[model samples]
Target: MSASYAIADCLTMLGRNLKRLRRYPSLTVMLLAVPIVFLLLFVYVFGETLGAGLGDAGRAGYLRYVLPGIVLMTVASGAQGTAIAVATDLTQGIIARFRTMAIFRPAILTGHVVGAVLQTMLIVVAVVAVAVLIGFRSGASVWEWLAATGLVALTAFAMTWLSVAMGLVSKTVEGASNLPLPLVFLPFLGSGFVPTGSMPTALRWFAEYQPFTPIMETLRGLLLGTAIGHHGAGAVAWCLALSALGYAWARRSFNRERS
Candidate 1:
């Protein structure tokens, strides 16, 4: 297909995916609920105790500290929904039908990735709004806000691509849903809820080296004026690497299915 034709195909598929999301809003709702629930739970239940660890910051301080992690967790939460959607399409004979059509084959997967990213960002916005209402304050300027938004979107795009690959490989919808569970909880294993410093030595080292930690740290720096250090580079590198790897895997899997 010509570049322009492929672009059109991708847009059509994206529109179709979005309409599906609207028709059955449950998936989006479920994706949004998990991170928001965790946000409220950790901030309300453990905020006082955990905030004390940040010196004199307390609950309000903890809210600011933890919001980045919650936001990243929200991005991760979208993986299951994307995987389920992809698996449903693949198993329902849609992929086979599309294969016979004249449209660009990869556009179908692109549609899923784009749609998931959009849903994820909307969930992020709602979560951030709730955080703001509950006293999660940030002194980030307009530029900082823009940068943070871009970073979150990039992270979501990367995770969505990986989820697409997982879905492509899944033999069942249930398997697809469960396969991305690691992505969901990875933030917790990093600096999501608590500082890496507070973790046990081995856990702390792992936390510090994980992808989410640098991403969260970069977010904290942008939003809360904390030091970003080397995290900005690390976050960009990790997102790019994951995106490339996921795209290659998903495309190879889809092509193999075609043959």
Candidate 2:
């Protein structure tokens, strides 16, 4: 297809997936609920104790510190739904029907990726709104806000693509759902809940170097005025690398299934 035609086809497929999302609002609500619950639980229940560890900054300080990580977690949680949706489509023979149609082939997958990213973005926004209501504050400038937004978008895109690959590789919908569970919890292993410095040596090292840590740190710097250091570079590199891997894996698996 020509460039414009391909873009149009992708948008058409995206619209179809979005319509499905609209028709079943329950799925979106369920997917959104997990992060919202976590946000509330952590900010209200755990915030006091956790913030104490950060010194006189207290619960309010912990809220600001953790909000960025929570936002990223929201994206990760939404990605699970993407994997389930893709697996469902595959198991239900929807993909097979698409393969038989004359529409652009790549659009089939593009549609899913785009829809998942958008859904995750909305969930992130809702979670952030809740965080603000509960006293999450940021002194980030306009440029900082824009950069943070870009990083979040990049993270969502990368995670959505990774979920798509997981879904394509899974034998069933349940397996797909289970496969992305690690993504949801990765933030905990990083600097999300508490400082990595407080962990054991090995765990601390791992947490410091993990993909999520750098992303979380970058978000913290952008939103909460924390120092960026090398985290900005690290986040960009991880996102690009993961996105490339996900694209290759998803495409290879998709083509294999079609054949």
**Highest TM-score against the true fold, candidate:** 1
Considering summed lDDT, which 10 consecutive residues are worst modelled in model 2?
A: 34-43
Candidate 2, residues 120-161: lDDT per residue as tens digits? 888888888888898888899999999998999999999989
TM-score of 2: 0.98
* Strongest candidate by lDDT: 1
**Candidate 2 runs further than 4 Å off:** none
Error of 2 at 2 (Å): 2.0
The TM-score values for the models, in the order shown, are: 0.98, 0.98
**Per-model CA lDDT versus the true structure:** 0.93, 0.91
Candidate 2 differs from the real structure by a C-alpha RMSD in angstroms, to one decimal, of: 0.9
Residues 25-52 of candidate 1 have per-residue lDDT tens digits of 9988888888889889888999988999
* All-Cα superposition RMSD per candidate: 0.8, 0.9
